[model samples]
Target: MMNIQKWLKHLSFASMAGMFLILVMGALVTKTESGRGCGDDWPLCNGKFVPAYTIESFIEYSHRFVVGVVGLILLATTIMVFLYSKRKDAKWYVGGAMLFTVLQAILGAMAVVWPQSSAVLALHFGFSLLSFAFTLLLYLVYTRFGGAMNKGDGTRLTSGVRWAVWGVLIYSYVVVYLGAFVRHTEAVGGCIGWPLCNGQVIPEMAGGTAIVFIHRVAAALLGLSILTLFLFIRAQASRDSAVYQAALYSLILVTLQILSGGFVTLAIGYDIYLLASLLHAMLVSFLFGVLCYLGIASVQTAERSSAKAYAASRLP
Candidate 1:
């Protein structure tokens, strides 16, 4: 039984890792302008299972292969969880993950087949990230249900702290969308500078510049929000080590993301910064996973506290 549980955990982790890699490869496809390399092919490259030699076609086709493999792994993981896990939460998470993974695949195919505008292409990243988030959540459920992890018992948070954390997580998604927009609209180099658009504190609201500027503003807000959350975590009621560590790691990633963003804008230049941009995207995906975990942890803590209070009242 212990061995089975460990196997399930490993499978779950592998599925999530595959999903993360798919996201990175999708970024590469977009960054390299290989989206049309397959020429509107849904699941095929250039009307062939294996396209005739071409760099763009190879990149796009390889991404498709990765996506297919990840999808299969996710399906297997979901089935395994359903069969072996007795926890209702774990079962539900698995079901939801399967559903989102399907939806993500559909969106990806549509983007290739249809004449999707930049906005729609931007949504592709958002949807992919959501799928990744669900997979991470499923992994956490597996870990906890298999007794590989323990829930943290921490002091009850004031309502203010709860609201603040929730707000930060929600706003972070907005920032993510704006960043995707910057990429899809080809506005990554619109400003040509970091912390300021061109030489001005405010960039001219024209062409891709406006979208890039909005992204910058959103990023700034996200940074402030995370900083606030970090300070609150430091000062608030004692937290479990896992919670503390996750929050600390999130702050660090956000800081690194900011630095990477600056480097892409200054040192690398958009034309050759595909790797850096993709790294930025990957970091944000990981950050979202951490945020989702923290959100669930907060809710679980609240529910346990409420149950304890009710039980004590009945005893009195």
Candidate 2:
């Protein structure tokens, strides 16, 4: 018989992978302008359970089908974790993952059926990202509890390191929202130049140009924040391999994302932007996963610190 713990861990990883694919497919659907491919159909393509043979229709419909399948997988994983895991932490993570997945699906359907403004559609990406993060946390909990867990020598975090982690995580989410806003507003190519919109260091703050400019500014800030985070981790917390490695991975992904964002603008001018945009979206999803992992690690570190402090007090 397969061990239930091992099975649950695998299930958690599977759910996270599925969520990542859903995010990528969603980017494809939007980049290809497939949002209207089904002609306002909700839960069906062009009023049919099986969509017809059209490129846009197939892309959008397939994304919906994949999302549906992933939702079921997440629900099942949540139930199994809740039933079998001994840790209350595991239960909470699984429950949160299930809730976020459900909310994401509802928002996705509403985006299709309702007259969603660009702002609302952008919010959809934010919801999807949150769902992805929760799934990642669930995976982390499963591994930490089910496998040979490593507690990282119980290193104490300095105030600066702690605040850096917290600040970068918060700022990363803001950058994510701005990226989604850029997509939902269809302003991906609104600015024809990188570092500057329209070859100017500062473009006129007017119309969609402002949205694109804001997103660029957020991207630059996010890149700097991640870089600073990595440097801090290397200098102060290098002994904590897990934390240091997570910070390094996040830094690399964020850098790649920034490069892809610029390439997307340039490629779109050459009419090859769709693929670049898809890659850009995939990087953001992966970055979200890494950030979520870091968040979980931070929490565990804090709990360990609290326990040590309490024990030291009792010794007195």
Candidate 3:
């Protein structure tokens, strides 16, 4: 039984890493304009089992292959969780991964066979991000075992702090989607500068410029929101607590995310922008995952506190 559990842990970690790869490769496909590299084909690249020799076809086909393989691993991990694990939240994480994995694949297929609008294309990335987040959360669950709640050396979070954590998590997803929209719409050029749009605090709200500007404002707010949440969590929880550490990771990632946004702007019109773009996507993916774990830690801490209080009241 112990060996089986250990194997499950390894499998979950692999699935998590594979999902991360998919996210990076998906971003690569978009940045290189390789979405149509397979020429409107699904499951097969350019109507062949293996695509012809072309950079675009290779990227597109590789992404498809990785998604298919990782998806199967995720499915196996989910089935094992149901068969062997007893945690209720474990199911939620794996279930989310399965659901969004399917949705992301369908969206990718539709984009190829039907050529979706930019808004729809942006959703493809959002779905992929969610899938990656769930897989990451599942890995965290397996590695931590009895859950981070068991290490409750920290103080329970206030209702306000809990709300703030959940709120920021949801808002960060919105900011990510806006960033995806900017990519799909090719609106990066509209801004032309980081921390400023066309050399102004507020540029003309029209066309691609408007889209980029909105994403910028949204991202800036997300940074501020995360910073506020981190400080609040630190004040309430011990520095060594899971909740506090998660918040600290969140703060660091958001800071890097903001800096990467600036780096991307500076690298614009240069080939280096591709690397910068990938860095941006990678940071956001981890940031979202960390925030999800933080939410879980917050709820678990609250539940632990309530259990203790109830037990105390029952003491005679």
- Which structure among the candidates has the greatest lDDT? 3
The parts of candidate 2 lying over 4 Å away from their true place are 144-153
Instruction: State the displacement of the C-alpha of residue 93, model 1, in Å, after optimal TM-score superposition.
Output: 2.6
Question: Cα RMSD (Å) per model?
Answer: 2.1, 2.2, 1.5
Colliding pairs, model 3: none
- What's the number of clashes in each of the models? 0, 0, 0
Candidate 3, 228: how far from true, in Å? 0.8
lDDT of each: 0.78, 0.79, 0.89
- Report the lDDT of model 1 for residue 294: 68
Task: Kindly provide the TM-score of model 2 when superposed on the true structure, using C-alpha atoms.
Answer: 0.93
Judged by whole-model lDDT over C-alpha atoms, candidate 1 comes out at 0.78
lDDT value, candidate 2, whole model = 0.79
- Per-residue accuracy of model 3 over 1-316 as CA lDDT, tens digit each: 8987887788889889999999999999999999999997788988999878899999999999999999999989989998897767778888999999999999999999996999999999999999988888788776753368344544699889999999999999999999999999998888888787899999999999999889888988999999999889888999887899899999999999999998998899898999999999999999999998888788888788888999999999
Worst 10 residues of 3 by lDDT: 145-154
Best candidate, TM-score:
3
Q: At residue 102, what lDDT does model 2 achieve?
A: 81
